[model samples]
Target: MSAELRLASGGAPAPETVHPLSVRGLTVAYGDAPAVFSVDADFPAGTMTAIVGPNGAGKSSFLKGALGVVKPLSGEVRAFGGPLSRARRRIAYVPQRASVDWEFPARAIDVAAMGLYARLGPFRLAGRGDLDIARAALSRVGMERLAERQIGELSGGQQQRVFIARALAQGADLYLLDEPFAGVDAATEKALVEVLKGLAAEGRMVVCVHHDLSTLQAYFDRVLMINLRKIAEGTVAETATPENLRLTYGGAAQAA
Candidate 1:
């Protein structure tokens, strides 16, 4: 599929708008320990791309780098052919369920409404339009019925869905999800996959940091094999070969 998607120029100067994400010489570190180094890649628009690697392979760090939560030691990350800060509104981030303190006092709807905070800015109350968007996002994730429920009462899968709904409410063109399927039920995983596929079909990019190699072929249109550096980035047919798997897994050949 073509990566390019048409958007109204709106009098902006004509610039080459290609991939939704472009990383060149990206390096990430944590207190003298470098996790990622000199990574270069382009994630095409309107596709589901998976970043797969073994544990401690810096997949999570890479996602954080893209979100600007973790500043890179060097290199650059661009969204929609522009700097990340300029295109921040066009990006939605779905962090791992474990990353959040679920005990925090908030309802499902309230959590989902946080997405609208970006548009509302700070020190402002959520208006009716924000509520409508929140409701719509919850409905998209099949969580509208639980809108009034406390966030602490949700199961792991439900909590993850709520976070995803929050991202949906942001109305972003690019999605970055970290370990979204981890510890979730099979039904929830299937539902999440469908939602992500729908997002990609709508000409929005969705990048997932996933671990399971068995479902790689079924879940993503493109895969990035990484271990501090990009090993490969291509379709399953091109990059998921046995040799590549050996390299990705590092001398371990488990049956997928």
Candidate 2:
């Protein structure tokens, strides 16, 4: 587990190059009990990876730790081969839709504009240029038409898209999303998948906490299979096998 596995379909990526995200001996806990065990993993640049696991499997906790929002009991997280603090500006995180209170009195465009605040810092407010960028990001996610609508009025998928637009407005080099496809329809999933692929094509790293196993190969370049700890990590072709899926999902995977 010391050496990171190469996920290239052609072959392993060049060893001389550095990974965009590196986790070492990471352990995250919500109390005395550890939710995420020591997970050492690396994500290379320019790839879309899915972090798939069952419910309550600590997938979201891993994301929170990686984003520095959840404090780790032990270990370290590095981005762009350096400390996360140095790379904070280059990272964007999209939280799960269920965690947000849609009735919080905000327009769709207003939610998206929050992304630009990274550049503005805590004390500053978004101005016209920021609003323009926010609208552009909303347009990218196909949510521009609903910019004036309240977030509470949008559909589940539309709300998800608005959150993504918010992340898009950040203009970060790496993106992490949690359960983005949870309640979305087929059309929304397709659109979101294409947008994620486009991000990778632009040499940005995209990691998602996904639940779907069937579409793993079709949508992502790499897949990280976990069950409270790292079980498998590599190209979808390699790590998404039935045996590994079984190990990650146990009897549930078999039942499915």
List residue ranges in candidate 2 displaced over 4 A.
1-16, 254-256
Clashing pairs in 1: none
Name the lDDT of candidate 1.
Answer: 0.89
lDDT of 2 by residue, 157-231 (tens): 999999999989999999999988999999999999999899999999999998877888899999888789999
Candidate 1 lowest-lDDT run of ten: 1-10
* Tens-place lDDT digits, model 1, residues 1-256: 2335344378444467579999888899999998988888789988999998888888999888877899889988988878889998899998888889999999999999999888899999998889999999999988999999999999999999999999999999999999999999999999999999999999999999998888888999999888888888888779888787788778763632
Candidate 1 Cα misplacement greater than 4 A, ranges: 1-17, 253-256
Clashes of each: 0, 0
